[model samples]
Target: MQQFYDFKINKIKNLSSEEKILRKKNLELFYLNGFPSKKDEDWKFTDLNFILGQNFTNIVNTELIPDEKPFNPINEFEHNFIYLVNGKLISKNFDHEEKDKILISNFDYKNEIILYRENTLNFLNNALAKDGFSLEISKNYKFKKPLVIYNYFSNSLKETIVNNKNLIILNENSELTLINFVDNNSKENFIINTIDDIKLKKNSSLKSIFINNSKNNAYFYKYLKNDLEKNSNLENYILSSGLKLNKFDIEVNHNAEYSSSNIFSALNLSNYEHQEIKTLINHNTPNCQSYQKIKNVLNNESKGVFQGKIFVKNIAQKTDAYQLSRALILDDKAEFNAKPELEIYADDVKCSHGSTSGSIDLESIHYLKSRGIPEKEAYQMLINGFLCEVLEKLNENNLKKFLLKKLESQIHGY
Candidate 1:
């Protein structure tokens, strides 16, 4: 492990001048923070011992490519595909104009903002990533076709650090739908760190879908921060399927009045898989609304966590905030931890939070059996109904249908 660390340091020392500065800044931040420990309230439930203990030495170069296709099951889905193998963009599939909108080749960030990003996990991607695609949608330009960003990893001992600084500027009265899939097809241990930054102008609408299907041996760390302007609406769905260790951080800031934010997440855990989703919503202006709902299904000895909080400032009167979390435990060994919180200084605001952890209803199952339905099929139907709420919000019929099929395949195994 020490040798691997030494090798990584030596390799990074050979990077270009710009990359060197980023790397130096990141290393300093990492040394100070040291991968949010269990002592940190937000990280108390997810364990990182396995990832920290591994001998990860490689820095996946752009020259290295994946010989195998990561996604064969859902090849029929129509999408504007931006494929990444081992953190590097294949370039052939990328459109220059579209790419520029999503990625910023040069950025001049303020000192405080830079420091915040550098100390965050996103910085790991900025420092170590070989390459990744960027997508920018024009202001108020609606996308008729679904935009799909696929992150693929296919090598053992390889770390794919994808630092994506996405600037989604939506002008007034425009709308779009996006499907993002973070997938790992390799049996090898890979690490992924991703960042998605979005800013919505007045009256723009966005529907986003996130799917994480990394391999059971992989570790994924993802962050999404959004800035909502007045009268803009954003609906988000986060799906966690495969991976040994999965950690996610999401923050939504209501910068203008009359904006709305809805966050929905579903996690399915099997084997020894571990998952965590931590989120925050801040109401900085008056009359903004935010809703959060998350669900988890744990089987075998898998573990899961959901931590969510909403803060309504004193000046943010007429704010409405709600949060809910539910977990289904299939076995005695399976475990779940939930922390849903609300902090409101505005006396006139409406805010509430709730959480539940339990197993499938036996009575519901008995009723299905009494109707002569087969046990396995009946059980699957009940499970589908439980998770359908999140999928139903996709709005796009084709995308919803596709996700339902994927959910079916996933639920049957759970």
Candidate 2:
């Protein structure tokens, strides 16, 4: 395993002596465990070590200086954007909103303290991460348009690994809508490890969306940790597709009364691709609500996984939680795995979980074809309606239309 990875802390620039020592210690810790395998309970369904070993021969951490490239803004809707090349912040524009209400800058690695040590990937990120962004929204301010983070990878990243960390904070009574858009077109094989910390203060609300622009050969992993305060609301919608391998580990903590959180995902996997979404929602306070709905469509030896857990503390009376996962298998070789769990110490909590997986209904396809629809079009129409239900709650018309088009492309294997 050591032969497959080459990491050097000195390769990163502008680090103090103490920072260097801390990074070295973290790198050593990551080397001790290497990449996670099926032995780890959280990663039992996706064997990351085995998968990476099969795809990459040598992965190194190197300094990146991206060449000058033109920035392409999304035309479907009006929005602000931040352009990042190879995880480095290149430019940002916030013309749609009040400039004084937003603050953006590079991640402050010098003053930030490490929060989690149990995950080896966190250790790797702490050691090798060099570039990322930190954003904060002022209190009582709301964005007039969504902000998009355009994540781009350079063509020179073949056989290389990139690690970065991001921080987002919304103060009291603030609101925001964020989009994490991946715009990679490079066919070169690479790896991306990312960690995001989100803090929502009292009375704040946030909506986050993730999606991809095109197909690529990138293996990606992201750990998102969110903290919610009193009367706060958080919602996440993931439509990421067209990657070779991807996994999202999300954790939400309801720290105060009347806070709510929701997780929704719809994925279409084709060919040999694999994708997973794992979530842990903790109801530590009374009168909190959490919901999760995951849907997947698999085709031609593709695989999908969903692991969801709800935890209610003893003091968390009147907690409400629900979880459901559904999968549609388009081929005999396709596979789907689901694991749902509940741990409640409160007697007054209302919690439930369910999972279902099956092949698409042949009767529905036949009925559509009988109405003069072509066989191919009938299958596509059925598939489109099955997966688009996840976005019914989204109120943004133009953005929703754009996402619907992307979802259709994924279903058609374009």
Candidate 3:
């Protein structure tokens, strides 16, 4: 590990044009702020050993493009499909008529970028990104089709780098659904860094689902920055099933009054795997509401981590905030960690945070066994019931059903 760190330090001087510039910036920021360690209050639960011990080789392999279309599985997508192989979008699927709401360009790498200034992970993405999709939704434009983007990693020989950029602008009183799918069928090791910038206009509603079903050896680094305008609504969900290492960073800025935000996540971890999710909600205006619920099921020595924070500024009075993290350990060796926090500067507000971790319900399992059901089957039923509480809140019925099916597959595989 010591030698690997030294090698990374020495190789900094030999990077290519784009990589050298990014490396210099990343090294400076990483040195000044340092990696978010377990000792750090915000990262106390997530394990960083796997990421810190190895120095990944950054590859600029343009030949790593995926020829297969990402939307081939969906025959009737009601929305548009913007496909990305590695990081670049497929040129054949580009549409010019949607320019107002969707734009594809090399994201400007300016130092004055608002979202990446103080964020360590965001800094890494900006400095080391290869290519990405740029999506913008128009104000007051209603679309019938959903916007789906498949991020495919298909290289085996070298460790690839993918940095995706998404810009979503929702005009006042508009609505849309977005699906961000990360699918990897490769047998190689790689890294993915993506940034989503969302700006919600007044009275707009946006629903998004993030699917991580890589089913391969990969690392995921994702960050989301959302700014809510007055009287807008934003709903977001995350589903995790694969990958060896995954890290998610979310920042929601309530800039206007009467805006509401909801964040929901479901994770299933098995074998020797690790997953971490970190969220931050900042209330800069008055009368905004935020709700966050994260649920996990861990077995076979896998680990799950959840760290969330809600911040209420001095001017943000009458803010409503709620956060909950719950985990069910199927085995004695399985692990789960939760850190729920709240910072209130306002005089009048309602805020609550709760966390619970335990095994299957013994009483329920006993009752089921008494009814002629096997012990294992009874326990699986109990586990499914406990997880459904969060899934019920999902607004999309199809998505909810999809989540349940995945959950079943994960538990049965264990």
Candidate 4:
């Protein structure tokens, strides 16, 4: 650990003066406040002992180019694209007709990002983020297509840990759709940590979708933080699968008036795969609105978790917020855990939270069996019907069909 830390400090010496100072400050904070442990309430349910047990001090190899480049999975995708191989940007100029409407640059390092939480994984990621990127959509530029960013991971020569930072800044009245897809190679086990910091200027809107179809026995942790200004709106969707262990941290802070958000997540799991999603929606200004709905389908011995909280400040009046988490357990050994919380300091706020989880009703299954359907097909039909309620909310027909196809494929493969 000492050798790796010393090597990173020396590596930053060649950067520009402004960046060097920022990197040094972050390093200092990393040393002062180290990793977090289970004693912290936020991390009590999730285990990190396996990660802490490994040796990530040595970075033996650098992959400048991917073994093979990934093309658009769907030919109908007409949007801009960016690919990250092992968390490093593929340095290439993409020639497009609307190139002048976009700005993409290398992200500047920041020490304060590490202080957002006391989690050790966040600390390690910020301390070792070698390369990342910044993106901005010009004002009033609404594209006909969404921008898709693929973060791909390749096997490392040694045990590898890659951290990538993304800073997305939206100017006033600008709107953009983003698909953050995390893909991987099947060679070895690695740790991939990504942090996204977003700033939505006044009246700017952002819609984001997170898709993680990880392969191999790697750990995927994503920390997402965003700030919304007055009249700004954010809609976020998450689709995750295929990892030994997966976790997500979504924190959105609303300090401006009349901004709103809708956060929805749908996870499909089978086998012993365990996944969790934790989110915090903070309302500090008046006349704001926010809502969250998280649903999951667990099969075999798979496990899932959803912890969501809504916080309204004293000054926040007429804040409308709600959270609901539901799960469908398909097997006797399958398990689901949910914790929904709400904290409000104002009297005029409207807020509510609830959690519900259960398996397929035997009466429903029996009725299907009596209708001449086999038991296995009956179960599949009922499970598919249960998840379709959540999928129906997607407004984009193309995206809805793409995700529904993926959902059907996974169910059939199982």
Best by TM-score: 2
Worst 10 residues of 2 by lDDT: 111-120
Going through the candidates in the order shown, the clash numbers are: 4, 0, 5, 0
Ranking of all predicted structures according to TM-score, beginning with the best and ending with the worst: 2, 4, 3, 1
List ranges where model 3 is wrong by over 4 Å.
3-23, 31-35, 49-71, 75-77, 91-115
Q: What is the lDDT of residue 196 in candidate 4?
A: 85
| Candidate 2 Cα lDDT to native | 0.91
Which candidate would rank higher by TM-score, 3 or 4? 4
Please rank every candidate by lDDT, starting with the best. 2, 4, 3, 1
- Model 2 segments beyond 4 Å from truth? none
Q: Model-by-model lDDT, in order? A: 0.69, 0.91, 0.72, 0.73
Q: Which pairs clash inside model 1?
A: 101-136, 102-135, 102-136, 140-171
TM-score of each: 0.86, 0.98, 0.86, 0.87
> For residues 26-120, could you state the per-residue lDDT of candidate 2 as single tens digits?
99999998888899998999999888899988889858776657767789999999888877888999999999999999888898755467589
lDDT of 1: 0.69
* Model 3: per-residue Cα lDDT over 26-63, one tens digit each: 65775455446666565667645336446354433233
Report model 2's TM-score to 2 decimal places: 0.98
Could you tell me which residue pairs clash in candidate 2? none
- Provide the RMSD of all predictions against the true structure, rounded to 1 decimal: 3.9, 1.1, 3.9, 3.6
